[model samples]
Target: MKNLDLFDPRSVMDSDFSLNVSGGDSDFGFAFNDSNFSDRILRIEIMDDAPENRPDSEGCTSIADWARHRKRRREDIKKESVLDLTACPEEQILNCDQPDMEDCGDCGNPDEEAVAMSEESPSGDEAGNSNDSCWSMDSSTVVRVKTLHISSPILAAKSPFFYKLFSNGMRESEQRHVTLRINASEEAALMELLNFMYSNTLSVTAAPALLDVLMAADKFEVASCMRYCSRLLRNMPMTPESALLYLELPSSVLMGDAVQPLTDTAKQYLAARYKDFTKLQEEMMALPLAGVEAVLSSDDLQVPSEDAVYDFVLRWAKAQYPKVEERREILGARLARFIRFPHMSCRKLKKVLTCNDFDHDVSTKLVVEALFFKAEAPHRQRILAAEESATFNRRYIERAYKYRPVKVVEFELPRQQCVVFLDLKREECVNLFPSGRVYSQAFHLGGQGFFLSAHCNMDQQSSFHCFGLFLGMQEKGSVTFAVDYEFAARSKPTEEFVSKYKGNYTFTGGKAVGYRNLFGIPWTSFMAEDSLYFINGVLHLRAELTIRH
Candidate 1:
């Protein structure tokens, strides 16, 4: 009886699906190649709007204008994702010459148009009267209706959207014919997606076309197609324009895992290209928010200091957002996190506290946190930097600044003394082997300028390389100053600043003093993996300076 039911022609005739016994000679196999096997017909209604008449059709002369256009287009197309094809009456025709509702002062609200586009109307009058936008079909605005024979099972296997639409027990799911409406710009992309659903390959090769398909795939929830599009785009040669476009994609599309790698590559490209921020100031100043964010977030930015970063951010915010409230909002929310407040100078931090550009509460909190970080001990600061995760706690992580930061504790009661602390990573010391030096920014004590220098020096007696520390006076001429100095380092078993050398020296203009080999050990032994001087891949040094009063 079951076999008889299956063989009944009446059963097959009443069913929405068709079974084809004959095979075809195509690579996609019989089901994909035979039109008789297609279960559903997709009628795509393409609405062609005049480019000159579009509300957003103005020529984009700059990246800012282009960004705004992209945002508006994103908002306009969001409704196309959840289109209700069954709601439209078969006999009704919509005119496309409706006033540009966006420019219309009396048309309820622009968002109401989006709401009307996505929703189903009870009757033609309701759909016609609610908002007659571009999605509607009429003889004047409708370019053409593209009819395609599609297999529901094949499409359902590739996209959850099709699967749900076919199996969700809706009236449209039971119907033999289904309809879709889209702008003429999306017609080629829609056709490409359908072909990909059948053969798992796309015929479009250009980046712009691929991007369209990627967005269409995202709208239709086709993960595989989206990944394919991303891979192809990443393989193509990237330009600044294309890279910014990738970074500025709608958040919904950018958040997908399939497209993340492409966006990351774009970010890295921009970061590398604009690494020397000082040289490219003019070019970078014109960049939109996404491009600026990409450039600023890099750890390898070659700026003089975080002070420069703060100034650039302020300038950018002012140029982009002239309004004070909007500028403050952007600075507080989007750009402030990348400034590395803890690494900025005390002077800049003070300016931050008094600046009216930032919210009072936010500036106060940032300044307080920076001050606390500055007060932390060298080891405590290292711990904070090491423990911070990549996402939320990057404030403690230092960038490659021209002038390395130092912690100084001054004492007025103890005859004008200052204890300066400097920490270097093992790799930084390793890079200085044979003959190299690293300098700290100048510190002042008793109206005298001084700096600490670490070098790999040759011990004349032993004729071998060893690590050295020196204290130098920046002033020149006949002025002579006397000072008591001491150099210490943290070692294994007890990571405390143990005194390595101490001496009293009278300094003249352009003069320096210190032991040639501070550790009294060869470079190889001092830099050995089991060396006692290194604590957790970091070399901590402290210098105490006291005036001989």
Candidate 2:
């Protein structure tokens, strides 16, 4: 029955699938759909549990069989004896009963005595004890002494190299581990560097040494010390002179190396002192142009025309000026405003004054006119030539304008009147104007009342009027209003007051003040009979006025 079942296609497919038959005599075998023959065989081995019908074993070994074989072989061998172990014990353990005679007789223990003796001995002392007596007479004796001469363990622990270097008296006398020298510099720099090295801090009051210390710290590779020094240097306030010097330093040094050291206050200091630098630069430029020509032409070469002399000096000074902006500013400030007229040669002056607004030409013209009016003939020909030149330039401009036909228009303002009065009633008729062109109005009230009234020309093309309205309210609920009026005339007409109002107004304490006007009417008028009301112990009133242009 089972063989018949195996013949069925479904039963054969479901049976343990195998691609290869090992022990069975079948030459051909069914192939499985999946290619994994080892897994298929493993599944067959798992399902075939019956001893007689189990899958034929081809190349397989049991772990228990191998272990039993190994156990039987191991059991046939003999174990070695460990009772007579040849390992040697330490010398101290071997001589435990023997009294340690390395120390003095009264010493509690040899090790302790040796340690005490080593500590008490001087740095170079080697005769404190001898180990020769304990050793065989024929055996050679070797002595070892280890000495650490560190004075302070804490300092030594920080840096063993430093500790060792100082411990051996290497830093004794003037031959210290670190040496600093300031060459031809102010004492401040030397002091600052010294303070940083010794105490890692600088005196707050030391001015000159502050920056110098920073430079020194950067030179030395002491990171922690340099950080503290940099902080102190950054905090120091610089005077104007120092600030200028600071600005003159190398750009690389200022921007790259020391930029982080700068504080906001220091930056402000530099800004404030910028003018001094500007002046300095100007002076440097001005001096050379002053008298260089005269100096070149002088017989003595030393005493030239004041201009030439000034020019030479300035040129020489400018050549020596630093290239930095701060230095340039100093030079500029000094030279720019300095009076260069006295030292200016006539030729130079002419060249400079050739511009439309030449100072020399103006001054020369004034001098010539003074001479002519005084009946002095100093240089009549020169004076006449300058006068003609001036007249020609003026006429040239005038002709150019005439040919271009550029019109010049003038604007007229409206007439205004302001009036102030004291203790005037709120509804009183303060003043009156006859029927005329009412252009604008404004008012203000404070300690004194202020009012403005403007009248404009009705025939103008376009006109505008502005006014200020200010009102002050008293504790008694009484109010005062003041106004100011301004009128402007223009070519383009704006919308009449009939359409829009053109003014800003603000009201406080429930009181209002503003200009009022109406257009398309016969005339603008203000009446004193306007209504007034009182609410919540506050006075409410309406003041209306009509203005026409």
| TM-score leader | 1
For residues 1-549, could you state the per-residue lDDT of candidate 1 as single tens digits?
A: 112112222233234432221111112433342335454445555655445323232355443454455565765565452443234323212222223323445323422221111222234453345234324434324456665555666666566566656655544455545556667666677778877776667887766667778877887777778888899989988778878988866535433887888899999999999998778788999988989988888888888778888999999999999999999999999988888899887658889999999999989999999989999876788789878855655788887776667777889984999999888889989988889988776777888888888999899696799999999999999879999999999886476679999999999988999888999989999998899888878899999999997
Model 1, TM vs. native: 0.76
**Where's the lowest-lDDT run of ten residues in candidate 1?**
18-27
Candidate 1: which stretches are off by over 4 Å?
1-34, 52-140, 251-255, 390-392, 442-450, 460-462, 472-484, 502-513, 547-549
Clashes of 2: 39
Give lDDT per model, in order: 0.72, 0.28
TM-score of 2: 0.21
Off by over 4 Å in 2: 1-199, 223-237, 249-259, 263-267, 275-549
Worst 10 residues of 2 by lDDT: 37-46
* Tens-digit lDDT string for candidate 2 (1-549): 112111222122123421111112322212111111101100000011222211111111332232233234332212211111113111110011222223325322312211211222222232322221211212211122211111122222222222332233321211111211112221333334433433344563343334444443443323333445445545665654343333332222323344344433344554343323223434334422322221122222222233443344445544755444433453344432232332233334344334322244444653344334324221332354347455512111111000011111112234222222111122222221222321111232233222223222121222332212222332223432333323221111231112122332332334534333322111122221332211211111222222223
Candidate 1 RMSD computed on C-alpha atoms after optimal superposition onto the true structure: 10.0
User: In model 1, what are the clashing residue pairs, if there are any?
Assistant: none
